[model samples]
Target: MSQATPPRSRRVPRAERREEILAAAARVFGSKGYRAGSLAEVAEQVGITHAGVLHHFGSKDRLLWEVLEYRDRVDVEHLEGQHIPGGLELFRHLVTTARRNADRRGIVQAYTVLTGEAVTDGHPAADRARTRFGVLREDIASALRTVADERGVDLAEQDAVRAASAVIGVMDGLQTQWLLDPEVVDLAESTAFAIEAILRAVLPGVEPLPDSPGASGAP
Candidate 1:
C-alpha cells in the first residue's frame, strides 16, 4: 500500500519565510550558543519540524551564517546607505552601532568562540572569521575616510584604517566587557563617550570650537 502525503498548511512567502527562520535562529542561538542550539528548537520556534528547518537552511552552520549575514546586511542598510552620515549624526551612528552589539550576543559569542577556536589553524570558522573581519575593517576605514572628507580634513588611508580599527575595537572590546559584566554598562552612552574622544583627537577644529554653532570656525 502507498503511504499518504502529509498535509501542507499555508506557506509563508519564500523570502519572508527565510527571514522568519533566521529570526528564530537568532533568538535560539542568543539563548544557547551556536553549538548548543538545536535545529529542532529553531524549527519549533517557527512552528515547523526539524527536517523542515534543515530543508530550508541545510544545516546548523548554514543557518548560523545566515544569521550573521542578516546582521551584516542590517548594518549596511542602516549605517552605510545612500544617506551619508555626517556631523554629530555620523558619530551617533557609530556609537549606536557599537552599542547595538550588546543586543547581538549570539553573533558576538560566535565571533569570540570562533576566534578562539581559529588559533588551532584548521578550525571551522577560522577562515570565515578572518575574511569577515578584513571586509568589515575595510568598510569601516572607507566610512572614516568619507567622514574626514566631509570635514575638509585630509587623512592618510593608513590613518583612516587605524581610526577604523580603533572604532571597531571599541565595539569588540565592549562586547567582551559586557559578556563579563552586563550590569557594568550602558553601551550606548559608553560608546558615545569613546567615539566622542576619538573624534576630538582626529577631527581637529570641530572639537575645541564648541559652546556655539558656527563658533568662529569652519570644518
Candidate 2:
C-alpha cells in the first residue's frame, strides 16, 4: 500500500513557516557548520526541495542570519521574562543562562559555532552578533541602574558599563569552559557561585539574592 505524502503549502502561515525553517536551519548549521550546510540539506530536513527553501530565504546565507536572529530573540526573551532587583541579580541571570545553555547542548553548539564564524569579516551574522551583544549589555545595564535608583546609590556611568560588560564577558568565557568540559564546569552551578561572589560589589545596600535566583529554574 502506498502512503500519503503531505502536500507543501504556504497555508501554515508565512511567519510560522519561517520560524520552522529557521529552527531546522539552526540544528543543521549547528551540526554541520555554516560552510558545510547547504540549502539541499535544509530543504531535506524541512521536507521540501531546495527551490522551496530558497523561495522563503532567497539564499543559504540569508537562512543562516534568520537562524542567528531567532537565537538572539530567544535569548532576549529569557531575560525579559524575569525580574532582577539588583546588579547582582542580573549577574545571576547571566550565570543561570550559562547553565541552561550547557544543559541544552544543541543550542550551545549553535550559538558558539555561529559566533565563531561570525567574527570573520562579511560573515552574514557578524553584524547581528555585534548588535545583539551590544543590546544585551544595554538591557542589563538598565536593570542595574534601576537597582541603583532603588537603593539610592548612584554608581558612576563607567562603573555600570564596566559591570555589565564584565557580566557578559564572564558568561561567554564560562560557556566556552563548560563546552570544553561539562563535567568540570557545570556552568549553571558555577555561574551561581561566581555571581554570588560579586554580590557584595553590586548590591551593597540592597536586600540579598533570594535562596534560588528569585525562583527561576534552569537559567
Candidate 3:
C-alpha cells in the first residue's frame, strides 16, 4: 500500500541560509543601488520573510556592510596561498581578478555604488572604505617593494605608495568605464596595460606580462 508520503523538508542550516540571504542582498543591492534597495526584495529572492533577512543581519545598514565584507572575503580567498612575491605575478593576479569580475558584474556594481555613497559626510560604510583603501595601498606597496628588492632596484617608499594609489585609481576608473560601456572598455586588458606601463616606467628589467585577450600591446 502506498502509505503516507512524507512532507517535503524545508530546513536549511544557519550558515547556509545566511549565505543565501547575503547572495540575494548582493543581487538586489547591486541592481538597485543601496539607497534604493530593500530588504523585502532580498527576502523575496531568498524565499524568506523580511524579518528572516533581518534575523541574519539585524538591519539594512548592517546587511550592506556584511555584503561589502563578503565581497572582500571572496577576493582574499581568490588570492590566498598564491605567495606572489611581486611584479609580474601581482599584475597577473590583478588581471585574473578583472576577468573574474567580468562574470560577476553584480559584485562589481555593488562595490562601485557603495564607494560612491560612502563619500558622503556620514555613511555606514565610511570607516570600512577608509580601512579598505589603507590596506589595499599597503598590500600593493609590499608587492612593489618585493619586486624592487629582487631586481636590485631602488624605489623610494613614497614612490611606491604613490604607484599603489595610482594602480587602484586606474583599476577603479577602468571598472566604471567597463560597467558603463563594456564594448568600449575591456577591463582586464586595459588594466593590464595600465599596470604594465607603470611597472616598465618605474622598474626597469620588469618582465613583460603575458598576452591576454584584452591587452593589445602595452605602451
Candidate 4:
C-alpha cells in the first residue's frame, strides 16, 4: 500500500487566531517581561512561526500595545454593560476586581510586568501607560467628587486628584508585594483595607459600604 500523507491542521478563523496569539503573548510576556520576551516564544506557544505572529500583529511593539489593551478588556468583561462603574459603585467594583484578581495571577503578572517596563526611557508602552494612568486618575477622581456631592461635602478638585493618586499607588504597590510574597500579603484583603483607609482620609465621616470587605472590621 502507498504511504499516506498526514493531513494538515485545520485553519483557525482570523478573529479566533488573533485571540490565541494575544493569549499566548500575554503568557510569554507575563513570565519573561516585555523586554525579555520574544516573538519567537510567543509564536512557539501558539504553534506558529514568528512571521505568523508578525502577520497578525504587524510588529512586536504593536503586539505589546494590543496585549495591554486586551488586559483592559478582560478587566471589564464581567461588568454589567461591559463598562466601568461610576460613583460609589466604582469603589465597590474595584474591591470586587481585586478579589477576582487573586485568582488571575497570570493576567496580573502581565499587567505588572508591562507597567514596570513602561517606565523605561524610550519604551514603546510609555505613552500607553501614561495615558492609562491619566484616564484612571480622572475616572477615580470624578467618582470621588460624585460621592462628595451626594454627601453634601465640598471636596476640592486637588484633594480629589490627590486621593485618586493615593488609591492607584496603593493598589499598584500591593500588587508588587503580593507578587513577590503572596503567602504574606493578601492581595484582596490588603487592597480593600488600603482603599478604605484612603477613602476615610479623603472623605471623613462617610461610612464604608455595608457589604465591603473592609466593613467587616478588617484592621
Query: What would the TM-scores of all predictions be?
Result: 0.73, 0.72, 0.77, 0.76
Q: Between prediction 1 and prediction 2, which has the larger TM-score?
A: 1
Tens-place lDDT digits, model 4, residues 106-175: 5577678778989999997799899999999998999999999989888989999999999999988898
As for candidate 1, its clashing pairs are: none
**Model 2 CA deviation exceeding 4 Å by range:** 1-10, 26-45, 58-64, 75-93, 121-124, 205-219
lDDT of each prediction vs. the true structure?
0.66, 0.66, 0.75, 0.79
Which candidate should be chosen as best, given lDDT against the real structure?
Answer: 4
* Model 3: per-residue Cα lDDT over 50-165, one tens digit each: 98888999998778878877765655453546333355567666776676666667667767877888989988678988998898788888888888988889999888999889
Off by over 4 Å in 1: 1-8, 12-14, 31-37, 75-91, 205-219
Candidate 2 accuracy as lDDT? 0.66
Taking the tens digit of each residue's C-alpha lDDT, what string does model 2 give over 118-197?
A: 99989877888899788877877787787777778866777777777776777777777887887898777776665555
